[model samples]
Target chain A: MTLTKRIIPCLDVKNGRVVKGLNFESIKDAGDPVELAAKYSNEGADELVFLDITASDEQRATIKELVRKVASVINIPFTVGGGVKSIDDARNILLNGADKVGVNTAAIKNPPIITELMTLFGRQCIVVAIDAKRNYDLKENVNIFSENEKKFWFEVFIFGGKQGTGIDAIFWAKEAEKLGAGEILLTSIDADGTKNGYDVLLTKSIVDNACIPVIASGGCGKPDDMVEIFEKSNVDAALAASIFHYETHGVKGVKSFLKEKKIPVRL
Target chain B: MVSVAIFDYGAGNIFSLKNSLEQAGASVDVITSFDKPNIYSGLLLPGVGNFDPAIKSINENSKTKFQDFVEEDTPVLGICLGMEMFFEKSEEGIEKGFNVIDGEIVVLPSTMKVPHMGWNNLEIKKPGTILEGVDDGSWVYFIHSYRAKPKFDDVITAESDYGVKVPAVVEKNNFFGTQFHPEKSGDIGKIMIQNFLNVCKK
Candidate 1:
């Protein structure tokens, strides 16, 4: 197939401004969502993801307006995830112009909502965001994978990757797909914020098991990290935060690097 | 100023499509049904929602009006499910299509994933219409599980290899269709939309 691998920039937003993390309320604002989104779209980034870590329901309305502003400025595809709790939430974001609605804790808390979202908004527009962490407390009857002699199963996390759910990430991915999830956004809690590289072993395992397109998220520090993941896994796309947020590299520069590495990108 | 009407299937995807068209220098109006008089210069069938429901939505209010638009050559462009609906039938849904194209929509081979999603290059066959000024192998964004198999291959102006030769772009007289979403297809897609607007201007 002539399909090229995608490079997606993840923006963490709160109260209409892009932020670095949820805990850093005092950290300086990263950028405007609409402006950053437009910059990424113009720089050849294939797609974008906006994660609203804001916990308050009162301010959620602002996120939809933010989505509208970004959608107006950019032409590429974007997925918006701001604690999508119900069909109404997904509908609000989608109606505001988000191409796909990403559900994380909602899907974990009520698995049936996956099928419900899929039925209401076609499978293509539903994204099941799975924030999985490597749980070393080896449990029985779980899909176990290991690295460096450490045997563990990737456990699904909810509440913005703070709480662990005993559910196996690998098994949950298949369940999500069977439950009508159009795509899976697989994030490694252990790899996130590390800025070393992607957890290729974890990403590759999920990619191999799921027939749906998987986006490998977290742990991207440099262009080489992206190169390593694409070279290692069959994942359709790679999502990064700090690299783009911190201005380490532009989306165009990353794509040029990927193209040079013989990895197919939109550029 | 030229105006384009986007036939909203209520799939919540018209936002970017509207933005891209506006960026391409065309005023846009979102129309949910064709029962109303066609006021726009060009009509666009957006690619969103399930096949059956979208067809049902169209057949519910304005089937004949849409057919007339296609038959009389009013310059229409259908994207993804929009393009698939013009075929004779689809494996995704039991409802009959618009029959504008002599083809049937079928599931992509099991060898590949269900939804052929992402940016794939076009293997330009005989270029014109939306593919004008677009380079051969220019990438476009796509997200669909079903592909159309037209009875006449000549109607397919561009195709992409996905185990099967998936028709990427098709042009049959005043009617045009893309299996991929040009609005989501980055800079190259902008050019295609601008080209479609040029047709609308005429």
Candidate 2:
């Protein structure tokens, strides 16, 4: 059947607690990860993503526990990410009840991990998460493609956005897709936690190049923001943390608003 | 209690499917072999792997058991990749399917996204027990790249629109298959699981 646009609520969790961050820093506790996950699932959320923001060794055990608890209560598909460094780590998360495992920092450390996870668990379960930030300065010699004529192009980041990969975000998306990634979770580091709006220009660039589904994250302040991304870009899904976590607008409210805008959402 | 033998093909996640079956009031058992298909009232072939590898596992493990299970009039429900295996073959792989039904699995058009992920409404073509009480456009969770295309028109119970008309549900005699995961489709999913269990009770 024709796939409908998805509304996803991202829970950046630390030590089993849901947290929110501004530009990938200044993390603050929001609530329990399991509680929020269950709430989102029941409130008509199309999908849920639980990212263990701080991938510390000590918190690894708790992430698995959180996935198990969340999987038991929710009927919707949910994905788990953060600190997944190996195939065993991905396997443990899926076994513990995560429908998919997101790879960002670990994938950056080793690009082959994307293919490894895809081969072992199937592509549908491997989401290659890319945290990208805008870099305006560019030399005339270096050739890089951007959908927009804007001088700045997005750069990929690693280690929870603390380290830069110097890799072009659009180029990496195509690479990840060729490596058998099921979907691309594209988050704009500049727009993250700002609650302004999504980087429709950035989203459009990648969605045009990548063949798989792309879930646009960051800068989702209002339901109109989601509508704007859908209307402006070809993104398959939209994810936000602050607006949903703080009850700025619940999942149902966002879907209802999108439905009224003539957007195809499962309400 | 309706006992269901869930065929463990050594791939994909069965936790949710098993958990959903238990919650829907059925006794579930994860069986590696198809040796005792008659002991259970129903058989469930849940999958999440490539067609070739999955068929290899089934052929190497319990090929005859599945045929026996179906011949005995035991209710069978296949989900996602499991449903795709019901057909004669698939474009995704070279391995032939179980050939239980007259159909083949074809990939969704390249015009639309490959893996039609997320929830979409089901357009009921012909209502059956599996879709009993389910709304005509009820949303169900789906994450599949290929969908079944049955040979006979009457076999398609329901369809969903992507870029093309993707077959959502198919039923032929005692065999039933769903392209979407009923275990992950929320309340609608739970109800479909319960209905499958009810079919076993009959």
Best by TM-score: 1
What local lDDT score does residue B63 receive in model 2, on the 0 to 100 scale? 52
| DockQ score, prediction 1 | 0.76
Count of backbone collisions in candidate 1 = 0
Pairs clashing within candidate 2 = A2-B161, A2-B162
lDDT of 1 by residue, A1-267 (tens): 478898999998878888775222344578888888988888888899999978799987788788889888888889999689999999999988998999999988899999988877789999999988889999898988877898999999888877889999889999999999889998888888778899898899899999999999988889999999999999999999888987789888999989999998877
Model 1 TM-score (2 dp): 0.96
Q: Compare the candidates by lDDT and give the number of the best one.
A: 1
Which regions of candidate 2 deviate over 4 angstroms?
A139-150
Candidate 1: where are CA atoms >4 Å away? A22-28, B63-65
Local accuracy of candidate 2 as per-residue lDDT tens digits, B1-202: 8899888776657777888898878898888776554688898988576788777877787656468666848889999988998899999889998888898899888988878888888999987889999989999988988988888878888998888888889888888899999989999999899999998999
Candidate 2 lDDT, A1-267, residue by residue in tens: 356899999998887788898888888889988788889988999999988876669756877777778888888898888888898889888877788989988887899999888776678998999988887776443235454676666889888888887888988999899998999999999888898999987899899998899999999889999999999998999999888988889999999999899888988
- Report the C-alpha displacement of residue A123, candidate 1, in angstroms: 1.0
Worst ten in a row by lDDT for model 1 chain B: B63-72
